[model samples]
Target: MKLLKGLWIGFWSGLILGLLLKWIQSVTGEQVYTLLLNVDFVPVIGSVQWSEITEFIFHMIIALVIGVVFVYVAKRRNYSFGQLVLISLLMSAPFPFLYFLLSWLAVEAEVPAATDWSAFLYWIFAHLTYALLLPILYKTFERKNAVSQ
Candidate 1:
């Protein structure tokens, strides 16, 4: 049950964030995901450019896990909006930064190099969106559940 709830929150939040980021890219013509998504992984879901599809799936999983963790951390406590915002930013930043840094230093990864500012900024804002949405959606759902119950 917890997993489902988390996944639901994470997946939707991730999707919404992803769309928002895409829109940003479209508008700015900026390569927001230059580092993170530009990889040479074996295509698991798409044609030659499997990264697109795989990346989306990866984000959904990340968001789901973030939500689950939030639920656990949140428990019965009502976090202030600022706290939730901080939580969202904190929740979203580390994994990719570490992953890219480690992969680049440790394994000569084919993904974007660590200094890709555009990608980093995109990553931050994308996570910010996810972070922002996760709580709002989760709280709304929780409130509705409580009302029904």
Candidate 2:
């Protein structure tokens, strides 16, 4: 049940994050998502043009892994939902930086200019959204466990 909750939360959180990022980029005239998509080593195998179905599946898998890991790590630390969310956010901080670095190196693409505050802000917003949603999902699942037992 906990696992199922995690997966469900992950899907919603990931989808929301993706949509929010896309919206922000569209408004700001920045292609932040495109930048991340173009960055190699982010695990998009096969042709660069992945179908929508493939992308959805890949995102869900990634989100599920992140959700499960976050819950497991937080439980191991004996932390509450808020603490787990905070820790997960902190843990995920390196992903964007690594993405930036990899984009700079392997892709030969100039990283989004630091002057582009909108891009950075969009990235932060997306990360925060995912971090915030993850714990809520865990809490909901925990409640189900309590009620069932």
Candidate 3:
């Protein structure tokens, strides 16, 4: 049940995050969305021409993994709403830095350059947005789980 809740939250949050990043990129001409969906650095996966939907599914799969782990920890620790939010934010803090690694690894990919301050800021914003959703969605699902259980 907990796992199912986590998956639900992850699906919605990830969808929103992907759409938000794509929208931001469209409006501002930033490549943060490109970074979000880029798996071109992977040995075999990178070689395949993935459509936008496939890339989004890959992104959602990552979010689902994080969600399950996050919910499990939150339930175990009995974290307050504030704690959940804080932990989610902290967990996401390192994500923006991944852009640097991605830039280096996926040289042929159309992601933001390692030194692009503006794109980094946009990435930070997108991540923070996603982090905020985690706790809220978790709380919502917790209520439903409690009722159903």
Candidate 4:
């Protein structure tokens, strides 16, 4: 149940985050969206060109893992609201660094440059939005479950 709850939150949050990043890229002409779906760094998988939906599914799979871990930990720890909020923020805070890591690791992938400040800031905003939505989604799921129970 906890796992499912986490998956639910993760699915919605990831979808929203992906859309936000895609929109940002479209409007700003940044490569953030491309970065999000890029897998050119992966050795075996790098050889094949993936459709955007397939790449987005890869992203969602990661999101689902993150969600499951977060909810499992939260359930076990029984954290307070403030603590959950903090956890969400702390968990998401390092995401921007992932951009740099990907940029550094990318071979022929067209990702954002390591020093694109605007894209970095946009990435930060999109992640922060995800962080903010996590608790809300978790609580909503909890409430719905409670009512069902």
- Judging by TM-score, tell me the better candidate of 2 and 4: 4
C-alpha root-mean-square deviation, each candidate: 4.4, 3.3, 1.5, 1.2
Name the candidate, 2 or 3, with the larger lDDT value: 3
Total backbone collisions for each predicted model:
1, 0, 0, 0
Listed in order, each prediction's TM-score against the native is: 0.68, 0.74, 0.93, 0.94
The TM-score leader among the candidates is 4
lDDT (10s digit) by residue, model 2, range 1-149: 44666567777777777777667767877766555444344455533756645655666678787876776676666677778777877867776674456345444333466456667767777777778887777777678778999
Model 3 bad stretches (over 4 Å): 145-149
lDDT of 4: 0.88
Deviation (Å) of 44 in candidate 1:
11
Q: List model 3 lDDT by residue over 1-149, tens digit each.
A: 77987898788888888999999999999898999899988988899999999999999999998888778878887889999999898878788778788877874768888899999888888888899999999998878768988
Ranking 2 against 4 by lDDT, winner: 4
* Cα lDDT of model 1 by residue, 35-118, tens digit: 344444434332345557776776667667778887776655778767766776677667557545533642322443467666
Off by over 4 Å in 1: 34-36, 41-51, 76-81, 95-120
Question: lDDT for model 2, on a 0 to 1 scale?
Answer: 0.67
Q: After superposing candidate 2, which stretches have Cα over 4 Å from the reference?
A: 39-47, 105-115, 144-149
Checking candidate 2 for backbone clashes, the offending pairs are: none
**Worst ten in a row by lDDT for model 2:** 38-47
